[model samples]
Target: MLKSFDNKALEELNDSNASENERAKKGLKKRSDFGYAVLFLGPSLLLLGVFVFYPMIKTLYMSLFLTNNFGQTTIFVGLKNYTSLLTSASFLASLSSTFIYVIGVMVLTIVLGLALAVFANQKLKGIQFFRTIFSSTMGVSVSVAAIFFLFVFNPTTGLLNQMAGLLHLPQLNWMTDPNLAMITVIVSTVWMNLGFTFLVLFGALQAVPRSLYDAADIEGASKSYQLFKITIPMISPSLFFVGIVTLIGAFKSFGLIDLMTAGGPNNATNLLVYRIYQDAFLNGNYSQASTESIVLTIIIAVMTIIQFKVLEKRVNY
Candidate 1:
């Protein structure tokens, strides 16, 4: 028995040594592969640094200095632009409008998208056709969508006005009304983005395992119960992705506001991006624009990080 125990111990020691040697071999191979992986990734990294990171740094640097008379003169004025933006009432108003727009669009888009995705997920006749019809708007350009909305909401000759007239309802001056102008922008943004979000959610819904639903049914769980208990948790990751994308898009919105409202009616729909454009080109305040841009970037980055940190904890996987 002693000799048998000694032999067993020797066998265990030999197995342990073999496992360690195998792990060391794998580690060496991984290190060797990492060099090739870096070599392949180098070009894309270089391009990203040149186009994205370098310009980002340059924008921050330019924010610290002022350029005068079409870049003919330069002066270093640190933090003045930021201070002025924070104190200016118009900037503050535009900032508030931007926040409203982001929140409005984010909520409406997600709600509407989820509804449409669930509807499309049903096993109905020509469901594929319906899905395609809903998602077709994603192919339209932002400027094109803005133009379409502009004509549709025209006070006098727009389709919406015509419909209202036919119904004997009052016509709305969507663009001229300061109160409605931002709402109009939000509606247009939601319309333009709803299809993409719907597709994302629908894909996630389809990816859920059938066995889970089968088990839920066998347990006498109602469809609604299963959906809330299983479907939502299963698709939480996709919802997180959609939420982040929609929020970022909402923050960066410029083309729609530019084409539709042009920040008119006392700058009712002037978002941060439009303000940046106005500062850089219309006002010729490059330093201020750069400062605003940097601030906007930081806000977006912080919000995105918070979103991931919070939502990641909720995702089942």
Candidate 2:
């Protein structure tokens, strides 16, 4: 009887093994389909690797050596480039300018964006027209905006100076002065970027559930209270996103500075990115430029990590 039972169990096991083999065959066919899918994506992957990764690696390698007029020579100067970058007074001055520029742009953009979004969200007549006018700046290229502002703020014949003269106010040098040049750049950047931030925040605001507002009203919560307790928290994720984008844009800003100030007024408006451009192309200090590039990359990466770890945690969703 035991031998008969054992034979019966072995027959059941064989049946299960046959079923597994059939499933494995199906899986193999699925994997072949996936391989074909990957094959279709091969060209895009190759292009990205060649254009992005290869150049990135080459730039990193170029940062470590000294190149002269004779030919390319890899001297492996170790941390000399980094050391010089850190110790240089000009670099330190530019670093401070960059920090100021980043802070100014971020603050102004977020404040203006939040205000504009809140205003646009209101049930006003011709709201679409207002939004279009406000957001129109986003489509303007940075170079064009820079040039436009350059003309508009010209000390002699500019619109702003003429208006100030009409008002009997002192004519201010908007772009030539070191202090005012940076401010002009910051304001221009804020205006250019505010549209996207406004759209993002406005969408986030619209997405909040109406039921929550109704519940708040039922609970005798004031509009201001509800806004602080409900609307802001609900919109925190969008604000966080806008904040990071604005910060990164501020850091990488080169066009406005290049076109407007050229990091002028004794390097008072010189940002790290502009400095990198000057070093790489104008001065031909490729190694030093690479070093600055790496440092800037690390700074941006750290800020991003901090945003995720700290600020993102406070977001309701």
Candidate 3:
């Protein structure tokens, strides 16, 4: 027994040494591969450092000093730029409209997209064609979508007004009216984003195990019951993903706001991103624009964190 125990201990010691030697070999191999790794990754890192990191650092630096139209430093205002934006009525209005537009777009886009995705997921005849049509907007560019909607919302020969005339309904100012302009842009944005949202949710729907629905059917569950209970819970992950994406996308919305209302009849549709552009290029207040850019970044980060904390618990997977 003593001899057997001694042999067993020696075997364990040998195994440990062998494992350590293998690890050391791996470490040496990794050191030798370091040059190759750097060769492959160096160019990409250099590009990002120049284009992405430098600009970000520059924006932060510029936020501290007021810059002229030529981007030359005019004054070092430190926190004053931030405090001024907090009190400016125009800034406040822009903030308010930004929230309204974001919420409107997120809600409408998700709801409409999910609905369309569910319908397209049905196994009816020609469903493939319908699915293609539903997601066709994904191919449309933002500029083109905005311009197309421009013609559709035009006053005299616009499709909406033309239909209204035929129905004897009053012509509505979709763009000029302060109250309606925000809603109109929201509608167009939702339409533009619907295809992507639909595709995401549809893919999720398709991935759902059919066995769950089969069990629900066997138990005599109603269609609505299966949808609300089984289908929704099964797809909660996709819903959560879409919620985050749409929320961020809506916050970053600029093209629609610019091409449609140019940030408004009364600055009613002035979102933060567009406001940033206005300050930097048109107003030539680079400092204020940089400050707003920082604020927008913080806003997006904070809201995304909040959304994660609040919604993550409900995501089934």
- What's the CA RMSD of model 3 in angstroms? 10.4
Question: TM-score for every candidate vs. truth?
Answer: 0.83, 0.84, 0.87
Q: Which tens-of-lDDT digit does each residue in 1-317 have in candidate 3?
A: 01123334555789998987898988754245678879999999999999989988898889889888898877888888889989999999999899898889989988899899888988899999999999999899889999999888888888999999999999999888988888889989999988888998999899989899899899999989988988788888778778777888888999988889999888899899999999999998899999999989888777666555545354555
Angstrom error at residue 36, model 1: 6.8
lDDT of prediction 2: 0.82
Error of 1 at 78 (Å): 2.4
Clashes of 3: 0
Candidate 1 positional error at 300, Å = 1.5
User: What range of 10 consecutive residues in model 3 has the weakest lDDT sum?
Assistant: 1-10
- Return the candidate ranking by lDDT, descending: 3, 1, 2
Query: Which of 1 and 2 is ahead in TM-score?
Result: 2
Q: Which candidate is the best by TM-score?
A: 3
